[model samples]
Target chain A: MEKQDQILMKKQNKTYVLELIKNMAPISRMQISKNTKMSPTSITRIVGELQEQGFVKETKLVTSGVGRKATLLDVCGDVLFTIGVELDKAVLKIGIVNYVGGMIDLQTYVRNPLESYEETVQNINDKVKNIIEQNAIPVGKIIGLAVGLPGSIDYENGIVRVAEQLRWKDVHLVRDLSKLTSLNVVIDNELKMKIIAENTVGKAKDSKSSILVGIGSGIGSAILLNGEVHRGESNNAGEIGHTVIDPNGNVCSCGKFGCLCTYISEGAILADAKKMKDISSIDEVFVAFRDGESWALNILDRTATYIALAISNLACLYEPECIILSGNLIDKMPEMKQQIEEKCERYMWEPIKKNLHIVHSSLGSQGVVLGAAIQAQNSLFDIN
Target chain B: MEKQDQILMKKQNKTYVLELIKNMAPISRMQISKNTKMSPTSITRIVGELQEQGFVKETKLVTSGVGRKATLLDVCGDVLFTIGVELDKAVLKIGIVNYVGGMIDLQTYVRNPLESYEETVQNINDKVKNIIEQNAIPVGKIIGLAVGLPGSIDYENGIVRVAEQLRWKDVHLVRDLSKLTSLNVVIDNELKMKIIAENTVGKAKDSKSSILVGIGSGIGSAILLNGEVHRGESNNAGEIGHTVIDPNGNVCSCGKFGCLCTYISEGAILADAKKMKDISSIDEVFVAFRDGESWALNILDRTATYIALAISNLACLYEPECIILSGNLIDKMPEMKQQIEEKCERYMWEPIKKNLHIVHSSLGSQGVVLGAAIQAQNSLFDIN
Candidate 1:
């Protein structure tokens, strides 16, 4: 136990040093020791191993106030890269991400809606190799690949249990994809990944716990605490969209009636718009609402009310300091932000209202791709 | 930094040793070392500090397997006591709790509803001393006092912010009590303390995160995570009763329409029962339902359905493994347990429901008193 404790402490110190260098590079070992409050001897031992493993390197010395040169340490970011994929039915976006969660290059691939599972895997394989060749990056530099998609994903077993959007069930996502791409693979729900990105580098970076309320293809939420996404017992912790709100209302795909999503989702708004005429998409509803169409305004009013209800429920449950509203619905109807905020004030439990700050997703449509990559980097690099 | 780390580690080991001694008395040092997998030297050092502090004592030797005598340690449980008080408008229950969270002595006092706040404080001051002297316990052994009551309590400031049951606002409870007793005083909501006792020794003993859903005077909830109650930024995290379930329904006292409590709370059930006749209490409604009264049954059905809805929403958002259904509503009508369980199945979001174990509070009415004592012990003894 004594030896084990020492080893654990050493590993923790090493990770802390690595993280410090990642966040505050061009820093000297003395400064790292000062910031970490670790003894110089401990810092030397950890830094020595890091340097030998090519994870850190000595940068050019800079003269201090006393005209004394001090060596600066930097992370070798170019030595590793991760592939983050945002998958959907007809389109998938792939990004080459580095240690700092910055995407080197992003490319979108179009796929046939009727493409078989094997054909999709083969396409991804060919595209990945092409992207690597185009960037002239070594195949060895890619540590792992992570796929973010819609639906229930068994993260631990690497299986897509059910992806309603892709019309896929029981797909061995990691097993098949890792074999084709020849890299380690991880799969997770898109909203979970998006919250991970938001919690790590986006809007919720400073929050201890935060909720990312997604209003896209469907209404749902993802929770992030500390730096890890809260995946409940079955990795389906934040399935609020299916929570029955009006027992006598619309039936959901899950066979439940009056689910919150039925009243506030993009599809729900378009369905209401269809009662007047053939309104094909959410964009038309937004246009009509902007043109002072009373019908569209009523639909939005109902949607905003339910949105506030859902937000209040979430606030009561988690009491997280921040709630990020994202998804296609939020991105398109930015004006609704004020209306939703006002409704929240009405529906919110009084005592807890002042403690919360609800805001729009700062990452916008790019959160999923970046989030997928961030998860891959955190897992593969073990920098957590 | 190294010295400080060592000091911290030593204190942690000391606390761990004390806890082990409390749980496993009459055990040899060698056995403790082996069970903890800690070095013999570390165990010896920690045990020495515990003995010096008079918290632990070396007991009589016992014969070992080889016929050699082995020294054993035991915790002096009665060396310290904590005062636990459960307060309401007209009555207050006080208990002297020991190390095992056992209430050694209990006494209840009735107060004049029309009496001034100072007179009530004077009555409590006299009774506390009377109980201590009758039991012959030294005042020096009383580490601290903790009060549990209904309301939005500012725990840090030890103030009863708003207790509707007592019709009190901005009452400086700890300031008055600490002056009367000359002991440290901590005050918190009754639901918060109940969940603490439940989390530490009751139904949620083995669960990582659990919520206590209270449905007594009103509907509310308290959350426990990793042994700590998650008091939100305003110390009002689990205010689920105020969650708006219907925008078009009845307005709540908080000025919110269709609050969950307005449909499922004990007060709500009695309110509906009054329309058919003059049902003044939840107990009368329960008796009427048991007698096969259709109106009473209908009222219960609606209440159960809404209870299920609130629980489903809670399960979806928190995803905690255990949800302890409590409050006077469950206590008086135990058969409602079956009704609620069945209703939960109907409304629960499919995935999360399977992972949850909804049960009634095992500690029942004694939870608040014991929980208050535990908090006092944890805070004053610095055992946490």
Candidate 2:
């Protein structure tokens, strides 16, 4: 056969294998034949080829059926790995994940290379190389790289239009990273990653429409509707931090007065905490509040109220199933869960509020990393 | 062939003919054959059957490609009609629409029959009959009936759960309406209809993610994401009007304080306007403002500001291609076009605000009617 013929056959095989895995994973050859509308001989041949490629493995036999016991074909978790990097202004977090979404390695570094976009890209490239070499991981095993940044990203163009934390504007992060590593690179806004994480693994798994609230130094959110992330016209949807909750309260970084983030973010709580005394971090404030510190308690309550208001407004607009609250503040002070839930109940519409669930994120800080890895895997599957 | 086999073939032909009309309307039979992947002989046979059933007709011929002129096979709009009814607490609007989405007749009544759920449904049934009879439309030509109401609707069950305006709880609207009319009845929330309208013919026609703002006596919204209406897990999405924009503002009907609707709804504006002077309608208030009435201007300006804030928040969360302003207020004050766009500019992110186009609804009051008709058509297509 010619090279073109081989390519066509391979493409056809890939499609068949993908459909088989999606529908009948942990299924035997006999079951695949019945389900996939493929002949038993063709199924065996494809399975053999997939096994050789380390994409599928034969598990123990099932004994429930009347016919002969059959070995089940399952996805090989170790066949490939992908790197997921989430770059915030103050810290850079990276995770190496396998095909089944299990994190093989995770690391976080506190560094600010904001003044220069090139330096930041170089730093990420160096770190990725060092991690792979230190682990002695095979280069061929690594599939691709995905990054989530805090800004408006043009996923199609692979450009970061403006990230407030990084103070970068119109940076072609994907092109730079792709050139440095010679691997496919994907980037999107952090909020979109948050939503994707929740949709894939967190509280939003069962929800068709949901909103994931990321309350850290600044507020951001990801809106998932109808089982897909809702990316607005320019891929800048889910930028809820700038919504004005109080028109006369405080000026925001976006030069807006009384934005929601100015009242509910970690920065907001820290600012209020500073009025009483010098509070070093949001974690410290949460700890003090837990210890019955009046000032800290008052500040947390105020922040919770604002957050509740924002959530209620989101509910009214999108009518999502549940709002998953995550980020540095929630991760640090899980005890604030009751306070936030109660406030949402008070603020949201009575009918919608009755049906609403304010749940904490299960994946916590790993949400973005895992989501990025899944996104990269999806791209690979599309290529195949 | 057996009778069943003949029926199945007819159904298949009907579907094929519908698809051909949808894609190649105002097209010749020869063109349809090329587009549908069907043989020219089959296309002719199907077109002949469709013409006999009053579903299609031959129009003028056109010369093309140096070939003989071909007569066009077009949908006969007068052969079938759909009835669309929009029922609110204070008013009822009905329309008769043909296959091409053209309205044959429209009527409005302000009676507030919602005090009794059974009576309201009975009234609708009676009105539907009278309208059909008055127009001398044959009952057999009516394909289906669609109604857009307020509140959360179980589309599958046709149950209305807690429609505040109707003062009804968990009424089996579809079942009840089916008993009154032989035609298939479909019911959904008004916002969902707005979304359907926008997707089918409004500003969202070409864009995948779009938001529709309905500023009537009550403010609400409908969202279209990824080319589908985002109905959340429980069919209660797009309730943006109930979101709390101001914590200390006014108590809303939903028992929330400072919801977006409490500040920006036409009713809210009218309430404020009434306190300043005796006004008969929203149009009167707009007129008063135009005549330099300070109080009216103040109320309208404040209302516009709240609307702008809500739009900004929606932009941040959804980043839609365009946010359409529709419903009663838009019809009353066309000047809101400039006010909303200007205010949105101040609150939205630079990239998003720069590209955002805030436009008045092109469908006007007929939006819900056309939307309902489209909804009925979707049900027909949904038959697997």
Candidate 3:
């Protein structure tokens, strides 16, 4: 083998051993060798290197079948940390996340809807500094920062093409934030980030492939397959909001008539409620529905049907193991979940309806924040 | 490195070199080394082995910028052949396909809708024997056999879960066929195979990701991403026919209301036409439309609109680089393609519509056969 080939092989072996130890903690060196088919000398060398770097350590002693004791290896959970930020139209959430995707500390701030891109970047930078100082975290231990927002994100270059909710376009979010804090920054669509969190530690943790549907101000979905996001040609794979379901239905903000979002989105429901009884929020519509008002019942029932239709459509197209429902419409109106699932049973294709796990998001609002931090850690410390 | 690792590395290097030569033909060994970052000795050894195996041969000579002449390598296109079969309700198509996905010979036969699975298998076995004997081809050069049909295929296990058109359920097609002919058999959904052909050599050749929509007696779609079919949890990822578009619309055969297929499929159009006149086929409706019949025009116009709506919905959900329309509804009525494109222009989401290439299938009826043969070749000769 060439010298370069030998070096490459060693690096790969080290990464393999490290990942095995991290994922299968309290595993003996013999167990790693048995699972990986690696030689004992190679495992020992890699584990020693990982221990020297403080990423791994000896955990506990376990008895083998032959009555021999062996030390188990595990990853040091606090060796590295990441900053996750969720940037939305009305809120900015930041969290310090550890190696295991758990938040050490989280803070939420009310964001001005009309804030400029520059002002938002400055505010995020200041908050990040304050949080680090307040926690007294060592600077060297911070891996990077990841921001999740609603937009057509140029993930490779960290550019936001259009954020309808934030009314911002052509913002270089990653470059600006990285420059402000001197930390590596990554960005992705908020829904994509949320699905990653769901797949990692929430409702979709056991699903090999899953879809996360967010039906708030806009109706959108994100597909997670084998731990990777299926971002379509232009990071627009799950833009189901603009899909027309009724030709004669209401006009959507996207200039199409009878779009799926026009029937099921939170804004669309509120608009319908306002037309009926001068309602200002979706909660008022729910209250009226609970009070047995015909107008509210009509609006809510139709919305639930459309939501079901969207779920049916998603199931037909994705056929994922699970479909996770998230966003404001689902989170705030938990009572409507049953209505949507019942309608889904009526609308879904018979073959697909079987064995399909349609569940609500378990992480709720912290999904994006946790997902972004996990993504940041993954980006900074890739084993594959 | 272990002895086994050495052998594995050598095998991988051989496949890499063979693929490089196959994809970039008439390439010199020096250029291969430069592109692959492999030493000249390793490239020479692999190339030598490939030449000995009759898979590759030296072709024309090329001169570098320095005027140094070097012999280029090329694959032997006739080295291996595969049998491709397309099984449908009304017909069966069989072809002998070469290594480069070219059909050496093709034959078609009528199929009974209610034919038993065993009878179909026997028929296919006879056809394969006749084709091979007629060509006077040697048995050793034949790779395998692949069959594409309309249904949910358990591709890994080579079982047909359901073929609604053919009325087949739980048929062990691959096992039975292989047992009869002593050749490896693979099966996949016809649309999935069609899209594979489309991605390989048809309209979607340049598309990174694409969706194929088939509108006929039934409606279905297939997704191709990065050279692999996206078969979902149960090989039903693109079963878009049962997706509910209008809750108050007509009932679909799947017991759903207002399915996309109910408005656009050939049977749907024929059903609507028979309501006004005694028309029994879709071709008659097209003829009447061409002859300027008012009722015919109304039906065809609505069908075209629904076809456009399905395309728009596909575009919204997948955001693929292109969407290819296929099946009898599209192949027989070429004139409607323009009308559908016009409707798609009006209905598509503005952002996704801008760069999307909505095109008709270039392979037409031969797609499934060609793709099946290609898949057979890939399966029998996998080096990765």
Candidate 4:
């Protein structure tokens, strides 16, 4: 073999060792050798170099029968950090995460005084600056930033193509954010980020396939199949909100009549509740329903039916093991679970209904934020 | 390294070389080394063994400004064969395909006197035996059999979970078929098979994310996302038939009201056309419409509207690059394209509408057959 070829082989082996440490640590050299199909000598040499370079460290020692004890190498969790931002229709959330899936910082910003696209961008930049500064995080230690937006986004181009709730069009997000932070920027749809979050750190920790349904002001979902978030032809694979559930129902903002979102959106429920009386929030409506308010129960039942219908249709289509229900509405009203479960049993395939678990989001409203951070970390490490 | 480790390394290198040949064939050992990042000596040794094993053959040499012109190694095209069966609601079509994707034999069987599950299986087995015997095809060369059925399927366990068209439930297809044929068996939803056909041989040849919509007795769709067929949680990903287009419209067989299938199905069009007079088939309805029959045109328009609604919903959710229209009804009515495109323009996202191409299936009736064959081949080779 040529000298250059030998060097390339060594580099590839180093990458493999690094990836192994990142994924499964603190792991012993013998284990790494077995998993990577590498020689014990190679594993030892790579681990020594990584430890010296501050990328890895010996965390513990383990004894083996009839042999010498071995040291376990672990990736240095503090080597780098990632910042995640979720830009929703009515809220903006930020989170800082470490390499080992630990949350370092979290903050929320309400978008009640909604601004224009440029103004929102400026506000986000300002908040990010203040957070980083107050936390005393070094720019060099921040590996990258990931932003999750509510709408169709071009991941490759880093552009938010169209977000109906945000009323934004063709927003060049990555470029704008990169200029301000001087860090690698990545962006994707909020639902896609939610799937990533669940897969990486939340309920779908070991699940090969799962569905994350976000129900708040509008309904949306993210599909994870074969351990990866599915991004369809135009990066709009999980727009479940647009799926038609009521053919002759109310018209959606997308100009379609009777979309799933039109029936189950927070605004839809509030609008229906307004027909009876004034209700400030979904939480208030749920409280009223608990007190035997006929109008509130009726509205909740209708909303729950629509939610169930959408989930049943999804279950028949994807048959995921679990559907993680997130978003503000779910956080406010947990009693809707029974209604959704009952309707799901009535509508979905029997076998699927038997196995399905309609669980609330572990991350709650902060799901998108944590998901965004995980997304950023994934980009930095190239980990699935 | 130990002898056992060395042997394992050699096996890994051999598998890597085989994958390289499958992806980039008609190339030299030097090219394989470059593509796979394997040692040149490893590539040469694996290529030599592969040639001796009859898996690869040397092709014509290519001129280069090097020490010697290298002979190209290519996969043997006729090393194996597979059987594909399309189990439709009305008829069953079968074909034999070679390793190089060439069809060697084709046959169609109409189900005039449809039998029970046991009887149908026995009949299919008899037909396959006769065809194999008549053609003198070697059983050793036949790798497997794949069947496409129009309904939900559990691809993992090879179970026909629930096929409404065939009235099948919990059928252990692989187990039943393996009893009759020694070869391996694979079964999947018919629409998924069509998408496989398009991805492998038809209009969606270059599209990584594409949709195939079958408009016939009932509506169904197959989605291909991220260069892989998107089989949702339980191998039931593309159930476009049940998407509600009218919440208050006619009740569907699935007990849903105003499903897309209710409005666009051949039965729906025929039922609507019956109001004007006697109509035998969708082909006759299209003929009458082409001859300036106002009632036929109206039926076509309504069907197109429902189909457009479904397509628009799909576009918003999946954003496929192209949508292939196929099935008995679409084959007979080509003029429905213009009306669907026009309606889609108003319903789909503006950017998607600008780039979307709605067209007829290139393989037509042969698509399901070819798709089944491709599915068999995919299983035999473990192709994604």
RMSD of each: 3.6, 3.2, 4.0, 5.1
For all predicted structures, in order, the TM-scores are 0.90, 0.92, 0.88, 0.83
Colliding residue pairs in candidate 4: A247-B245, A247-B246, A247-B247, A248-B246, A248-B247, A317-B236, A318-B233, A318-B234
Over A1-384, each residue of candidate 4 has an lDDT whose tens digit, in order, gives 999999888888888898888888878899899999999998889888877877899876673576878877889877778899988777888888887777788999888546887788778888888888888887777889899888879999999898888988998999998887778899998889988989987898888778898888788888887788867666786678877666567887778777788778778888888888877776778788999899988888888878877777777556678888888777877788878877766666455666677777788777787888878877776321
> What are the per-residue Cα lDDT tens digits for candidate 3 across A88-113?
88889999998877799999999998
lDDT of 4 by residue, B1-384 (tens): 999999887877786787678667778888888888888987887888878867789888673676888888888867778888888667878888877677778889886435678877777787777777877888887888888888878888989988877778899988999788877899898889888989987898978778899988778898887668877656776787775566567888777666677788777888888889887877788889999999988878878877887787777666678888888877777677778778877777565676678878888787887888888887776321
Query: What is the TM-score (0 to 1) of candidate 1?
Result: 0.90
Q: What is the lDDT of residue A215 in candidate 2?
A: 87
Query: What TM-score would chain B receive for each of the candidates shown?
Result: 0.89, 0.91, 0.94, 0.90
lDDT of each: 0.83, 0.80, 0.86, 0.80
Tens digit per residue, CA lDDT, model 1, B1-384: 799898787778888888888888888888889988899998888888778777888888674688567888898778789988887665688889987677898888776667777886777778788888999998988999899887789999888887766778898999999999898898999889888889778998867888898887678889876667888776777888777777778888888888887887766777878999876767788889999999999988888888888888888777888899887788888878898999888777766777898988988767888899999998878742
True contacts kept of 3: 0.71
Interface RMSD of each: 1.7, 1.9, 1.2, 2.7
Quality class of the docking in candidate 1, CAPRI style: medium
Candidate 4, superposed: residue stretches over 4 Å from native = A1-76, A279-284, A351-355, A381-384, B1-83, B96-105, B129-145, B154-159, B172-186, B244-249, B271-296, B377-384
| After superposition, candidate 1 runs with Cα above 4 Å error | A1-16, A28-30, A36-66, A69-77, A89-91, A109-120, A382-384, B1-14, B36-66, B69-74, B89-91, B108-123, B382-384
Task: List DockQ for all candidates.
Answer: 0.55, 0.62, 0.61, 0.40
Expressed as tens digits, the lDDT of each residue in B1-384 for candidate 3 is 999999898888888898899889889998999989999998998888889888899987674677768888888888889999999888899999987777999999999888888899999999999999999889888989999998788999999988878888898998999999899999999988888788778887866788999877678999987767888888999998877777789987777789887887777888889999987778899899989999988888888888888889888888888899998888888888999999998898776887798888878788889989988887887653
What DockQ score does model 1 reach against the true complex?
Answer: 0.55
